[model samples]
Target: MQIPVNQKFRLLSMLGEHISMCIIGVPLMGLSLLTHGNWGFYFVLVLYLNKDFLNGRSPLKRLLNTQVQQTTDVPANEWQCFLRNTTLIIWPLEVLVVAINGRRRLGDYLANTHVANVSEDIGSWKKELAAYRVTSYTFYTLLATGLYLLLVHTLFDWLGF
Candidate 1:
């Protein structure tokens, strides 16, 4: 199915949300391994479940000025946000549905949530694009995680672990 240009943009931004989570999650996984505990995995899970925790938007969505609202066109409550993400645990199915059905995934239906573009103003987008705080953190964390994994692999190989 052909998604509209704006939906495609929103989809990409949402994908970045997953990437954003992995940026921190990988290092946390590494930590959990070294510490011999499941804390890091649990933390990542919590993050996924609560991606829209405080503001009904994930980090990437917040950066892009989008929001998850009820189908009635009000900002979704915390529970709605949480409910929507629960279906994401079955990522393959959710992704498939989204690819065929556009930006509203299965979870969105179950939770009665909808993705809303907060502003269509090019100026608003430019302003967000200029905001380095979110973008930089995601980029740098990904870079750092790459370096971290490489270092850990080298150390493990050197030690014959």
Candidate 2:
């Protein structure tokens, strides 16, 4: 299906959210491995599920100047947000549905919400874009640091040093 230009931005924002989570999550996974706990996975899941909070603008949406609002012109409540995100647990299906319908995923349909750009103002978008760059850089730095630590630990173990 052909998604409109604006919907494409929403899709990109959603994808970016997942990618950012992974950037932070990979390091958390390494920590979980070293600590022998599942908290890292749980923390990621919570963040994913709650990504529509903060007055209809989650971190990812804020970065992209997008907001998830109900079709009724009201902010989506927590229940709606959670219901929509439940499909995220089975991400392949969620992504497939989104690919088929850019305007609304299964979660959006279920929750009666859709993502829209917050405004047409260039200034808002520029500010959000700047923030997005910083967020991306931070995530990359954390991922790289985690990888380095894991490598050093492995090397020490291998050499018995």
Question: Highest TM-score among the candidates is held by which one?
Answer: 1
Ten-residue stretch with the least lDDT total in model 1: 120-129
Question: How many angstroms is residue 30 displaced in model 1 relative to the true structure, after the best TM-score fit?
Answer: 0.6
Model 1 agreement with the true structure over 1-161: per-residue lDDT tens digits: 11122557756866787789889899998999999975686578667866875446676776777777877766566667777876655777876777887778888889887788765342443463464244343554445445544665576679996
Alpha-carbon RMSD, each predicted model = 11.3, 11.7
- Most accurate candidate by lDDT: 1
Q: After superposition, how far is residue 88 of candidate 2 from its true place, in Å?
A: 0.9
| Position 133, candidate 1: lDDT | 44
* C-alpha lDDT score of every prediction, in listed order: 0.68, 0.65
Which regions in candidate 2 have their CA more than 4 angstroms from the true location?
Answer: 1-5, 120-161
